[model samples]
Target: MAPYSVYVRAVRLALEEKGVAYRLDPVDVFAKDGPPASLLERQPFGRIPAFEHDGFRLYEAGAIERYVDEAFPGPALQPSAPRERARVNQLTSILDSYAYRTLVWDIYVERVSVPKQGRAPDEARIQTALPKAQLCLRAINDLMDDGPYLAGAALTLADLHAAPMFAYFTLAPEAEALLAEQPAIKAWWASMSRRPAVQATAYPA
Candidate 1:
């Protein structure tokens, strides 16, 4: 594993928490091309996790999450039904597209060795992402209202996406204050972080 991408780490933790037997296949994504040659065969885009088991191949985080949920006999990771499952998928999309992608970049923009940093990652960028993150929190709050889980009473892949990225966000100076503004989000973050699986994998070693 190239250390651990926040998303990858969350999925790994989800599997662990659910007690699903899984093997971590470390693909060298920084190699000459994207990932290793073997991985390329499974993932045309050469993503880090190209899941294969029982002679089936799967790619993308959502697909991988679904496969893990189905293949493993343990706590369900998604709600049953087209609509509820769609909601879960939608939450994943919002996290990947709207919240985490940009919010998680705050530190990188402020700290990394990029040629140029747009917006200075200053108050402006931070402020922009904060509301967007709150948007994610609101959706999560609504989804979670039905039960403890984002999809329902059971922990699902939606929580998997939310928890770890929140890890990155809290590392920022204003994270607590920013998240504190959203009561449901603050509570949910607290709940998810307290889970044993989440606690073990949240911080980097």
Candidate 2:
């Protein structure tokens, strides 16, 4: 898995947070011809972060993260309380279903990555994504209400799940205004960004 992949970084953050030792075998899913055959062999669907542990194999970022948290002997990444655990799951689902596409692809990729790759950004796409992005942020912020973290009194998979996306999304200039509108999320990022796991898994420049 590449360090630049948000999904890969999410998994890595979980490993780092769990203090688990593991190897990250590189896979370029963005190869010119398409994803490498080796990746397809493990992931089947050509995702970047197919995982293996103790002879067990898994695909999909959420599944991998939960496995890492449960399989390892470390601080729990999931809350034990039913309501709190549900909140973690709910936030992760929102991030995966809505925020990932809007914040990462539509806004961050269009506004930041496109120019870096020597192509013009799709201004129309970014404009259209802004309201959607705001809705995602506000939804998350409302859920967070009076939090130092996303899922409540302690850090959980929810924070790890969202941090990687925020790491890329905040780089776009549009993020300044969009985040300013959601102070709870902005504050959450300010704290989450400083975690050792988050800093360690930072995208390479």
Segments of candidate 2 deviating more than 4 angstroms? none
Q: What value of lDDT does candidate 1 attain over all alpha carbons?
A: 0.70
lDDT of 2 by residue, 44-125 (tens): 8898799999999999999999999999999999998899899999999999999999999999999999999999999999
TM-score of 1: 0.79
lDDT of 2: 0.93
lDDT by residue (tens digit), candidate 1, 1-205? 4435676776676687678777776777768755777877887876665667778877776667777777788887788889988888888888888776665775433433132534344656656666666676666677666566677766788888777777777666666766676666776778988888787675555
Tell me which residue pairs clash in candidate 1. none
Report RMSD (Å) for each prediction in the order shown.
Answer: 3.7, 0.8
- Cα displacement (Å) at residue 182, model 1: 1.0
Report lDDT (Cα) of residue 98, candidate 2: 99
